[model samples]
Target: MADFIGPRLYACYNCRNRVALHDDIVSKHFVAGHRRRAFLFSHVMNLVVGPKMDRRFITGLYTVADVECSDCGEVLGWRYEKVHEESQKYKESKTVLEKFKIVKDNW
Candidate 1:
């Protein structure tokens, strides 16, 4: 018989609430505020997107909303609601979860 495995997940560091999936990771090489490491995820679940605000990043200006854990309300990262630069449009609707804020689950 063959063994079965489940989809790998990333959980909130504080409450252990499942937030993202390993397969959904778009890029591991990302940086958040204050030089903190981050990961770009193509999809995330159990998260609440906060208000949209304009912020300027190294790439360009974008409209983003803070994403929080739906269970515990912990701020995990931000989601790109709108991208101003055409070159950065691919990042729209994506979420960036801080590395330190998430822990591996179902590994």
Candidate 2:
């Protein structure tokens, strides 16, 4: 049901522990094609370590779903809400909603 294709609209860089903006999305978000910052830790090593690293440098970490605006490819930040809701809807469970409680409580 989900299309995991080439060149994602959103990428989670585990190396930096943050989501990164793609070029297309950056262009739409900034209107000048500035490189997106904030990368997750996983991506950092992938770029620097190459295949020799085996990608185990950053394990046991989870990332939120990618977000991309249809009107434009702007990376509108992480969509934890949307991702959680969709997972709940598809799984026919309220677990995601329940998890939001703690996140909301902290806020």
Candidate 3:
């Protein structure tokens, strides 16, 4: 999968400090322990955003990605909502991307 939350903004997904994307040595430290836990938490949050049975408000907080503190095995941040006014008209669309486009372009 594409790293939408690119390493440019994410540091090892474990370290809060800044680091390069391809720095395998640094990332490996994070990946080896906390990667799975972080991803799983983020995955669940993503699912909540795309609920099949309910229509919900668009909150301003969103789970951009998961992060772990390299110094400690702590899962930080997940599935947050961002506040924005959106119409429910697109709720029936096939994909959330389609809804996002419509909402963004005000179509």
Candidate 4:
């Protein structure tokens, strides 16, 4: 069973697309790091728009830009990936869940 509590439930701000449930949010990283927002892991299937190259937040490490909703153009957190050739999965996206509205009602 999922907690679906205050910070556990999250949906897109523009469109109520459920990006992640209780299980998805990265443990201990809740609302930490760059911004004080819930840092969760979302797969490509969960997001409406994919990651595009933006300015580097951590220079030479990863670059990120707005990840918007397909239905409504609302900024929902950001999507980022490693730049340097470290590993095979370095190119894979590692998004930090933020800017989403918590699902108030039943999640």
- Using TM-score as the measure, the top candidate is 1
Model 3: runs farther than 4 Å from truth? 1-57, 60-63, 78-107
Weakest 10 consecutive residues of candidate 4 by summed lDDT: 98-107
User: All predictions: root-mean-square deviation over Cα?
Assistant: 1.0, 17.6, 16.2, 5.4
How would you encode candidate 3's per-residue C-alpha lDDT over 1-107 as one tens digit per residue? Answer: 88455332233233343322222212111111223322111111111222223223233222232223334434443222332335422212211111111111111
**The candidate that achieves the highest lDDT relative to the unseen native structure:** 1
Which is the winner by TM-score between candidate 2 and candidate 4? Answer: 4
Candidate 4 clash pair list = 31-37
For each candidate, the alpha-carbon lDDT, in order, equals 0.97, 0.23, 0.25, 0.53
List, residue by residue over 4-100, the lDDT tens digit for candidate 4.
4564446676567666565654432545345565564645225654556645433244556556655566666666554453552433465555633
lDDT of 3: 0.25
**Candidate structures ordered by TM-score, highest first:** 1, 4, 2, 3
Model 3 scores worst on lDDT over the 10 consecutive residues at: 98-107
Tell me which of candidates 1 and 2 scores higher on TM-score. 1
Compute the lDDT for candidate 1: 0.97
The stretch of ten residues in a row with the least summed lDDT in candidate 2 is: 93-102
Q: Which stretches of candidate 1 lie over 4 Å from their true place?
A: 1-3
* lDDT preference between candidates 3 and 4, better one: 4
Error in Å for residue 67 of model 1 = 0.3
